[model samples]
Target: MEFMEVIRKRRSIRKFKPEPVPDELIMELLEAARLAPSGTNLQPWRFIIIKSEEKRRELLGHTVNFVVTAPVVIACCVDLNTYKQHKPQRIKELTRAGAFSGVDLNFNDGDKYWKQRGALNANEIREYVSINCAVAVQQLVLRATDLGLGTCWVMMFDQDSVKKILGLGADIDVLALIPVGYADQDPAPRPRLPVRELLIKELK
Candidate 1:
């Protein structure tokens, strides 16, 4: 499918068919995520493919809607350690490579921003990493749509329960949950803000 067409037709599918999604298709979706652009190419994302019935059930129990019936659930995680200590090195390398030629790459006190978002210390870094992981999730959604698959991004869940269920590493934080399968119903597009209302152009 064309890229624009995929973007236009993609919907948040709530109901899914019972048939299972193939492993190859799942890998294709993951490959799409792998190709996503990350800050400094850190690529801190990790995906946990949940296909086992028991695990799926546990996940469903934690989430309120839109995941139990889907054949595949991909849990997106971010490793805080991926960027914790590499900022200085990354800045130096980018500067040497001319990647920061037109940009202000200096972030002397990066933690200051995170602190404002309620990220206190090292533990909060994991939460900050999860925000990056969400970018990969968006890529997965778009790619899945291109593949003629239905997907729903679910987040209304017990994060701690999900982390325990998935047995993720201490430094890993769950960013988003995606359920993929064939759609049972064609949902109408939800209302969106008009471009004129959303965009602000500053004329100098």
Candidate 2:
């Protein structure tokens, strides 16, 4: 399918058919997410594919009931440890590859730079992880649309409880829950603000 068509057709599918999503297609969706861009190429995303009825039932308390209707529920998580461990290595790699060409890369002052800090503070880590994880999830959603599958990016959930249910470690945090399958209903296009209202300013 064409890119724009996929974008137009993609919906937050709450209802799904009984047919299961093929394992190969599921992998393709994950592949798209795996290749998403991240800050400093830290690539902190980790996915837990929940398919069993029993496991989905466990997540029901933390998430919406509609999530379990889909054949697959992917628990998207961010590894704080990965971000902490990989920044320096990724920076060095980029420096070697001229990614920061003609730019001064400094680590002399720990106070002034995030790279120099031993680790990001809790809020900083959450914000950074959220942005990167959202990108990956978006890619997964778009790819699912292209494959004639359906998906929903579910964020209205009890994050801490869901994390515990998924058996995530201290270094890992659940970012979003995505339910995927074949759609049972065709939803109308949602309302969008006009372009004029969206544009804040245009500098000459």
Candidate 3:
């Protein structure tokens, strides 16, 4: 599908057929996410592919019960440690690649331009990591749609409980739940704000 057609056809699929999505296709979706751009290549996104009925049932306790009906529910996660561990090296790498041309690389004074990840509070750090992870999630969903799979981003869940259910450590945080499978319904496009209303300002 053309990119715009994929965007237009994409819907928040709630109902899913019993047909299983192939593992090869799932890998393609993951590859799309892997190629998503990240902040200074921090690449904090990690995923838990929940394919078993038992685990889906367990997650249904926290997320919408309908989510369990799908054959796969991906637990999209953000590894906070990625930023903490790779910040310096990524900055150096970016410097070498001329991402910040004409700027001197500094090991002291926290590099002045690069904000210190360590300075962020617990909530700030999570939000920071989640933003990067969301980019990857969007790419994955778009890829899934192009491959004739259905998906819904489920966020109205008990994050702490879901985290425990997935056996993720403190450094990893579940950002969203994506249930992927064959579509059981062809949903109408949800309402969207007009482009005029969406733009704060338009310059010639």
User: 24, model 1: CA deviation in Å?
Assistant: 1.0
Per-residue lDDT of model 1, residues 39-64, tens digit only = 76667899999988778888766896
Local distance difference test scores for all models: 0.81, 0.87, 0.88
Task: Give residue 79's error in model 3 in angstroms.
Answer: 0.2
Assess the local accuracy of residue 81 in candidate 2 as a C-alpha lDDT between 0 and 100. 75
TM-score versus the correct structure, for each prediction: 0.85, 0.92, 0.93
| Predicted candidate 3 versus true structure: per-residue lDDT over 38-157, tens digit per residue | 887889999999999988898766889878999999889999898779888997887777677653454333445656424667787788889999999999999999999999998989
Which is the better candidate, 2 or 3, if ranked by lDDT?
3
lDDT of 2 at 5: 97
* Superposition TM-score, candidate 1 onto the true structure: 0.85
Candidate with top TM-score is 3
Error of 2 at 24 (Å): 0.2
Model 2 gets an lDDT of 0.87
Residue-by-residue lDDT tens digits, candidate 2, 84-161: 688778777766776665534444222235545556788898789879989998999999999999999999899888
The best candidate by lDDT is 3
Work out candidate 1's RMSD over C-alphas.
4.0
